[model samples]
Target: MTQSTVPPLKVGLVGFGYASATFHAPLIAATPGLQLAAVSSSAPGRVHAAFPDAMLYATPEALYACDDIDLVVIATPNDTHFPLARAALEAGKHVVVDKPFVLDTSQARELIALADARSLRLSAFHNRRWDGDFMTLSQLLAEGTLGRIVHVESHFDRYRPQVQARWRESGAAGGGLWYDLGPHLVDQAVQLFGPPATIWLDMEQQRDGALTDDWFHAVLGYGTMRVVLHASALTAIPAPRFTVHGTQGSYVKHGLDMQETALRAGAALADGWSADTSDGVLALHTAQGVVEQAHATLPGAYTQYYAQMRDAILHGAPVPVTAESAHDVLALIEAGIASAREARVVQLRGQV
Candidate 1:
């Protein structure tokens, strides 16, 4: 039997919301080995306007069934992630699901099993791991400049006081700020320190008439080390993005990387686009004394995810954000939800 040559991966996108339009689509189109073949959106006209050369499908099924599309990137609502990803995998297409993975661990496991059975690449778009500030921190940690991490604090705060009427504000599966931002925080913790022995979460709805949790604080207990993950919709005065205390010194940083904002503002991916970012304020506590703040360079590369995904599909490279990592995130989310419901600490089992 003569082997067939596989052309470049044809990528299909679902949903044109903030994530797809700003993050996924632009990054996918910028990636070299992938092509924006089609998009499934109810607002077909808008999709056509954004991607004039790409085919527009009235339904996700239509997009998935197209013979030309080799990968499906799901950027839909939290509730639809499972169903669409499952359908894509069953249809023999490689799948990339946006964050929060799914509402529950069972669904995540099911999709994992399905992808494994089909020998397909199944991944979550946990792109924050590539944040420039985070990249700097990762380097410091690996170089032992921070020594043993004792306490880590991560925050994703915003001033969305007037809750927009969306499924995220509703009391639905994968709803609210926790679901929206928890994956990034939790994934960072897991990447740095692995799984926790126990998790304690406090969640509430501070917004008027809000149905889902708009505020959440979770503490991942890793023996002596602790990671605090917090998010709130009512933050008027946003706090530091990252604060870490270690035996050798402590690091405090404020503000988010500017790549995503730049990408949303129609910045092209070429040149120094993704590599540029506002220098994060860094205050390091040394034995001599607290060092004065300095501009810490951030080398953000959001395009790296798509590039790796393309290579994984084309050249059999390792998928940077693995399904196992996503499973750990979902499991932590489940534990956090459980803790909030029962008002107690939840012990995590499996996946150490």
Candidate 2:
């Protein structure tokens, strides 16, 4: 059948929170081969405001019960991810859970096994993998422009001084900066260089009302290469989005991707928005001395994820973020927490 003749995959989004509304909902709606058919939200008006025609359900189970929903996207709290995903998978629907795939690797492995047994597509929304800066950095490394990478630092710092009352900050089992932001940083690192050999972590409750760790610093060691991942709610001055050093020299870039901001402001999802960042600076060590130049960042196409996900359902394409890859991310997160608690470098499983 021709592309135009193929039917769109109907997706049921299971939450209307910041992640769902700001990222998942609009991206799914804009993808050519996907439809935002139904949503489960307590506030129907919230879903209707952005998607007036979308079918609304008061509870997630109700949405999962709809046979029309070919795919279920879980955008709920960290602790709720595994249960909601299991329920959706048990309902015989393809599943997509937001980042920090699950609270632990065991949960991720269970979902992976269940999906494989049922022959269903399972994926994680590691959207930051498509960030403009990351895309550019990937290209730089691919082209050997940075020579052999030796040290890398990635930060996702924010400036929220006062902690809000939310499940994410409630000191729950899966609530903390490490679980909240570490997945993105670690996933990006694994994308550039495979899983690390060891990880050392340190976390702190820096904010006044913080019941959970609001700041975290983790180091992933790969042989001679050392990567530092950090995030904090109390950061005032901006840290480099990425600071990568190689035998050639270093690459330094600042500022977060603007796609999320644009989406929050209701910018129509389009290819034009992929150019969401400024040129990053590259420093090279030359015999003459030090040479620095501005390197153009590539456009970040987050919409590709939903488009690819649609193909995975209809055309049997590989999932945008495979379940195994997300499992690795969660494994690293668990290791980081253990490292913080034990105050030592933790060796990653199956890595010698």
Candidate 3:
């Protein structure tokens, strides 16, 4: 098919909640060659208010059955991701599942095989890969400026001291900060250093009356390298978003990505939309003394994920976040959970 003849792929979002409203919907609308054709939401008024021209379905099943939808985006809760994605793929639609792809690796593998059999594009929205700070860090690593990374620390702390009445904080399957934020950190780690050989997890319910784990500290061991992932609900002052130390130097980033804040404030997509204001500190161990310098942050492009997905469907380009890569994340998550529950270090078995 010629580029000029290819129409915009009709997209159906399966949820209109925080992830849908804040991240997926805006990014989808911003990307070219992709159309937000419909959405599945309990509150049709909310969907209509945000996207008046798009059709609204009362259930995911209805949305999956829609012949107009060429792609289905599953932005619902963590628990619903697997079934919803399966249904969409079964309906002969390309699928995109939000982060923490699914509850387990088995589910991820199933979806991957199904999508492969159907010759459809399937991806997990590991959008943090597009964060300005992370992008900068990735560049630095690729350049080998940090030189033989020995220790890496990544954090996603928050001060949600009050236990909210939500499924995330509830004592349900796929509930807790571990499952919520673990995927981002783990995926980033795996992207940088491949899979860890061993995993050690320490998870707890720190907030008062919190039924699920509100805090977790996971240690991923990659030979001599150590990657620590941490998140907490009671943290008043959070730690650095990323800290990497190597044989040659160290890099420390202070703030989280600004895209979330921008989207929350309803900022329009513009030039330099994802540029970070704060600079990361890089300290190099010179022969004479340690030389410190400020590293310019890279511009993040979350819309690139959807754009690549559009290209993959229209032009046969590679999907940005493949189901195989996301399956590795789910494997790490499962290992972490087992390590925490069994009070022992778990060895990663398969190829990541």
lDDT of each: 0.87, 0.91, 0.92
Per-residue C-alpha lDDT of model 3 across residues 1-352, encoded as one tens digit per residue: 6765678899999999889999999999998888999999998998899899999888999988888799999988789899999989999999999988999989998999999999999999999999999999999999999899999999998898899988888898899999999999999999988888999999998878999999999999988999999999988899999999998999999988999999977789999778898999999989988999999999888979999999999879999999999998988898899899999999884645
Question: RMSDs, each prediction?
Answer: 2.6, 1.2, 1.3
Best by lDDT: 3
For candidate 2, report its TM-score. Answer: 0.98
Clashing pairs in 2: none
lDDT of 2 by residue, 193-255 (tens): 998999999999988878999999999999999999999998889799999999988999998
Where does candidate 3 stray beyond 4 Å? 1-5, 349-352
Candidate 1's TM-score: 0.95
- Native-to-model Cα distance after best TM-score fit, residue 147 in candidate 1, in Å: 1.9
TM-score-best of 1 and 2: 2
Write down the lDDT that model 3 would get.
Answer: 0.92
By TM-score, rank the candidates, best first.
2, 3, 1
Regions more than 4 Å wrong, model 1 = 1-6, 275-277, 281-287, 293-295, 349-352
